[model samples]
Target chain A: MLENKDPNRTDLRELGEFGLIDHLTQGLTQSQPSTIKGVGDDAAVVDIGGKYLGITTDMLVEGVHFDLGYTPLKHLGYKAVVVNLSDVYAMNMQPTQVTVSLAVSNRFPLEALEELYSGIALASRIYGVDVVGGDTTSSNKGMILSITALGFGKPEKVAYRSGAKPNDLLVVSGDLGGAYLGLQVLKREHEVVKVNPAHQPDLGAYHYLVERQLKPEARKDVIALLEGLEVTPTSMIDISDGLSSEILHLCKSSGTGCRLYEDKIPLDPMVISTCEEFSLDATLVALSGGEDYELLFTIDQKDFPKVKGNPNLTVIGHMTDQGEGANLVSRSGSSIPLTAQGWNAFQGE
Target chain B: MLENKDPNRTDLRELGEFGLIDHLTQGLTQSQPSTIKGVGDDAAVVDIGGKYLGITTDMLVEGVHFDLGYTPLKHLGYKAVVVNLSDVYAMNMQPTQVTVSLAVSNRFPLEALEELYSGIALASRIYGVDVVGGDTTSSNKGMILSITALGFGKPEKVAYRSGAKPNDLLVVSGDLGGAYLGLQVLKREHEVVKVNPAHQPDLGAYHYLVERQLKPEARKDVIALLEGLEVTPTSMIDISDGLSSEILHLCKSSGTGCRLYEDKIPLDPMVISTCEEFSLDATLVALSGGEDYELLFTIDQKDFPKVKGNPNLTVIGHMTDQGEGANLVSRSGSSIPLTAQGWNAFQGE
Candidate 1:
């Protein structure tokens, strides 16, 4: 009875990841009274008794998300859990538990799976969350990991992407572009190893960059910091897909515009030096390079004093009226419209 | 530093599915006070205020879990959600929400995904659960679906697999063996289609079996019926890995043995007749057939009167002392040990 009604089949690549999710989930309406937020958010919020529970899930596919040739199974497991927890942290929630599900082919031995789970367990212990449950099964090809993170937050303390108001200060925790550059270093090393099997390359100089890519720490501490400072972000999102894409998400959801100052964007000395060596623009990398796993948020102008001059946070820009549009004010005083040049799995594959 | 400690790579098949999960999660311990149960349960139970929340996840891999040649995308999507909801129901919790994640190769078009989401939405609507959040990405080969179901129940009313005591009556909802028989018919028809293309084989006679395989429903109605009858099960589980395997799990968790009566095993007329047609043993099929999505539970002897003569449930056996061991009494009066002949994704590949 479920025949293809349309004569022409539309290619999935025609609409990118965000567009595809939006198209498919357009008709779904929440019927459960407990479901506070369903789709179109970092995490779905549900009211369990008086507490607000945030639930988020993420999937990592082999070849699509990672390559096992260089990526250790343990790090892959740790990063997979961190990716989901980042979403919960983005909502200003304290993560309590996670459910990890995996699909692996016969090529993965029992020892390999054990190594993967060790990393998962380590992450669970470090983050103070319980590994409550999961499902493991055989896949047709390589490994696929899907994790669901559950966290809780007070009703008033929870943050959302749609809560930003015009004139709020845009804030970010930690530096950007390191993770993306780290991946570049790994990919280059992998290519070298492919050509010469016995090549022993010293990566001492790129230790920081490689670690950023391999083992990203989700900003659970930032959520706690915000609570300690008595500052609630007006809007918040995790920087999984570059700064440009995340800024657009907050602006679109909050029905506002933003002016991201180029000079104010946070960057480490290592990122600048590495970008110079690679002949890449540091600002462009920070704007378009993804997988930072840092929190990008906005707070009311009155709360600026709380985060001002804080090393953990950078005041990158400020929100503006919808008519002003989202733009990047370059150091040279040029107004450039921000575009999502972040990694799109569907495109350029 | 995450090097393989063992020189010999042990194949995953040596451990099997259940063994792999147990071995990997062996070192994990619950530190969260909210986490009531973890790892080894139908669903992990967490305390949210005074309410109990149950979380469960399941993964379905193409080629391994299903063959898309005959399986419709819509049915696959519907069944994925049902599989997870069944776990929540096994904990005697009311499913509140679900997150459905998908990883598909470029072979699937937008229409295919839309068809799948339609099924997901349909199932969500019917089950009274909100479609929360999910992740969709590209896969290396075939499609992979992972679903997480969230449910809620009263603290005192939640059932666990370890609560069964000796003398408690074992019961199951719905008949067994239909889904397994349905798969056999489909496989036979698939072979016929391969041999003679364009051959129109009638499937009208096997409609019930095929439906049982393609669109089996979770026991939500049974949960409500038990509540209406004021009968709360002491221990419960879902029949996903067949009666033999589920009975063993209940026995192992509760430290009790079970005496399953073969004559009391429920079977449909179609199932019995089809077993004869296929030259298979009906009792064996019923015992080892998986994917029934039926609820199996143990109730106190005092509560037997509440469920007695109920068409939705059948008293099949009773829990016994741990020394007795789990055994099934044959119709001819022979007590045979119950072996788990259910599908093992890791073995026989």
Candidate 2:
């Protein structure tokens, strides 16, 4: 189903774990001030009524989620925290505390765990999040890392996935699908290297795409950018499961419709060219490719002017009547229905 | 290292996940009204300031913190939520919302997940906690689950782990060590079963002890019990890592020393006999045994009588000046130094 649906997709391990996270998190634009901090922290911290604190956590296990030969523990640790913070950041908050939980079999020695923690500690230090409380146990199988991030945010400022609105401008922070294409290039090269270890494939040619995949940064910049532009999204969600799914979520929650422009869909040049090389459709990749942690939000049209022309802010579309449905305008300007191809590992074998 | 610690501990699977969680959560008495809900829920729900809400979460993974063969996933999930609520309850707060994150390998079919979630869902329904949100994904190896619980309490009502005072009455809710002894019985049985497939041992003989090991419940009941008695603990923590380690945490955090009475320590008769049969000391099991989910706390000396005759509350010790070391009075009435036997999977191999 995934192959039939996401032909533009490449193997996840190609870009590697670290690179995939970095690529996905890049080009994000945050738009709230209560968000004293966003992604990159132990837990995104926010100023919640300037009183108490809130926290959330998530875990990712390899072989359970991704193949290890292709996934780096460092990137795995970093991405685990990133996913948790996305939820907190969605609430327009700042993250401060974190608890790192890791489970490994005898296969992982102290050094490997150290490598994973090195990334965790890097995230801790860089994001100013404290390692507060957690447990480390041995797994019966592969490696698993669970991260809980605590942040400070006002009760009123916290956003839920269910807050989109009709007539709200459908805005997305940063470019899309670069991470997906980056995976394609890395997977292609990985296959080549597997057949001939001596082959020094020049990934340099796809430097931008590769970097986007390897070091995906959470759109920490967007929080500041949105604040500077003086706009608050009426409803918001981080784009982890691709644009199509997220837009559908916003539309369903806000009881509205959306029409995305094919020409307006943001993409780096390398993504389009890479899609051509794979005979894949760039639009579909933009719609269904997962992993980008960019913010997809809906704002009151009145605030649209404030976000418009902002380098990081991309006005991908706008909300419409409920019956209009979620669709994308082709480059030639024909509307087409949108569908999600996000991985559901439990689906029929 | 584990050889001397919990070597006789049985595999968790023999108890199944549900049985294990029930063993850990038994007889935990509640003490506060704000804790409108406890242990059985998506999240433990608490009535904060009568209107506001507060939430927190934590996750545990096997291999990272436990061995599933010895740690039941049901008990793991139960303990996972218990530990997180212990944090908020430590704050004199109550849990209100919770989300559980789980990553499982195909090694576990949907039936396995159903059993795991049945406990979680049951806890939520029983405790009145809402399963507001959660993220589910595939794992590379075994299984890992993370739980986040949200709670609420008035600003003045919330208690912090650091709030214990010098000379506070160190009180424990419920008996200790059955969970540990239960482990021994299971291990013995497991060994027997492993050596002879045709042998169907008399499990009824160790029912009580096995139950404690297979299903440990949180001390949410103690929260209500304390409230009824009109007493409040100055500092609190749930027993997950053992009494010695937890008391030490309160002592160090509160900047005090402690004296625990071995004679006064509560132990189920089954625990005592099981330990003797296993050639292990019951006191050591009480000190190092984890998964009790009972509350270890301190209260004002004036409030002593309210608990003195209460079967649920035990005045096992008292806090002292930092100059005094953490010590335990032996059953023979001798003072012995206390040391943490908590498993350090990180200990250099």
- Top-TM-score structure, candidate number: 1
Residue A35 error, candidate 1, Å: 0.7
* Cα error of candidate 2 at position B109, Å: 3.0
> How well does candidate 2 reproduce the true complex, by DockQ?
0.16
Alpha-carbon shift of residue B97 in model 1 (angstroms): 0.4
In model 1, which runs have C-alpha deviations exceeding 4 angstroms? A1-7, B1-7
The CAPRI quality class of candidate 2 comes to incorrect
Q: What is the interface RMSD of each candidate, in Å?
A: 2.4, 12.0
Which 10 consecutive positions of candidate 1 chain A have the poorest summed lDDT? A1-10
Per-residue lDDT of model 2, residues A225-315, tens digit only: 7777777777787777678887876777677888888888888788889889889998888888867778888888999779879888888
Error of 1 at A15 (Å): 0.6
TM-score of chain A of each: 0.97, 0.81
Report the lDDT of model 1 for residue A38.
90
